[model samples]
Target: MSDSILFNVIPYAAALVTLAGGIARLTAKEPAAPPSPWTPAGRTVLAGASIVLFLHLVGLAAPRAMQVFNASPARLFTLESLGLIGALLLSWGLLTLGLRRAREGQWGAAVAFALVLSQVLTGVYVAVALRWASAWYLHVTVPYLRSLMSFQPDATLLQAAPLVIQVHVLASIALLGAAPFLRFGRVPARTPASVEPGLLATPREETP
Candidate 1:
């Protein structure tokens, strides 16, 4: 009972945090100076993440797709293999962006980068170690998520999952909580590379 509450409360709180942050970001004023344009590395990170994210959304909205893919071990292996590939790309992307953000003294981005990097690293671990989460997601996490959506969240199934899997869930909640504050999702414009003080900063930082 208590574990179920803990599981349910965490994600709801995270949702509120994410919502508030998103609103704040949207309403926030523009910065004075533009930052550096996004490097190819940064863009690559964003692109890979976006694809991975889209895949998740599609899976959630259309469980049948996953069911179709997971009907056989061979099929499930292919799906997990693709997920691993995406995770690796995301790691490379984060590394590329993290180095640049750190060098520019974008501490906020640096922090967000660390949080998400941790999540992705753990995600890779889950993919490698568990080896068939795509199918298990349907059997366990999906129902758990459904319960959360229905306002009667339950961790009953998850409580039985392995410790590393629990850690992955915690990391995911943390990432969701931090989402509203981070600029990782922001895309810089394709304007001229202006060193001007009034130009916008990198997507990770506010302009001067």
Candidate 2:
């Protein structure tokens, strides 16, 4: 299989696993104990997803680097820098979330997992948009901008493409940086171990 297909498989699989885990957590019958801060199943699933995503990012970068020989330096730089930053953020967010969830308990884990997942999904969407845009635009605009930077810097600055890309880059960074903090901010004082099962406890009758 092609590198892109292979690379994509990891994240897709990760996403599937995460979805399944989330569903299981949602449907599980509450135990007698309060929900634990951490659930073994939840941590394992989330951790696996995070590792897969990390590999996916690395896979994504390899092709871009290879394309550098044919592409303009400026365009290549922009793409590489943005991609690297995005990957780093993704890694950090996933690692922090996974580790915290494993150590702290279920609530912490849920918060971290949710935040990281949100960022991951958002990033996937953005990447799809970017890929579509690159293909539809004939891949000329990026290379052209790179070439124009030295000769007609002013004209390039006036173009909207770079600015738009920059916005996306910044937004991605913000999402990564903020996710961890958000998870922490909402953490409850006491972690619930397990929820009580449906049956009610009965009172004993008084002896005669």
Best by TM-score: 1
lDDT tens digits, residue span 95-153, model 2: 56565665666676556566565555544444455553322122433343333334332
- Candidate 1 lDDT over 1-208, as tens digits, reads 4675568788998999999998888798967556667677777677778766766766677788789878888877787877778778888888777776777777777777777888888878877777776766676677777788899887888889887777777678878898776764344466676587745655567689
State the local distance difference test value for candidate 2: 0.46
Which 10 residues in a row give candidate 2 its minimum summed lDDT? 132-141
TM-scores, one per candidate: 0.79, 0.28
Candidate 1 residue runs with Cα over 4 Å from true position: 32-38, 183-208
For each candidate in the order shown, give its overall lDDT on alpha carbons: 0.76, 0.46
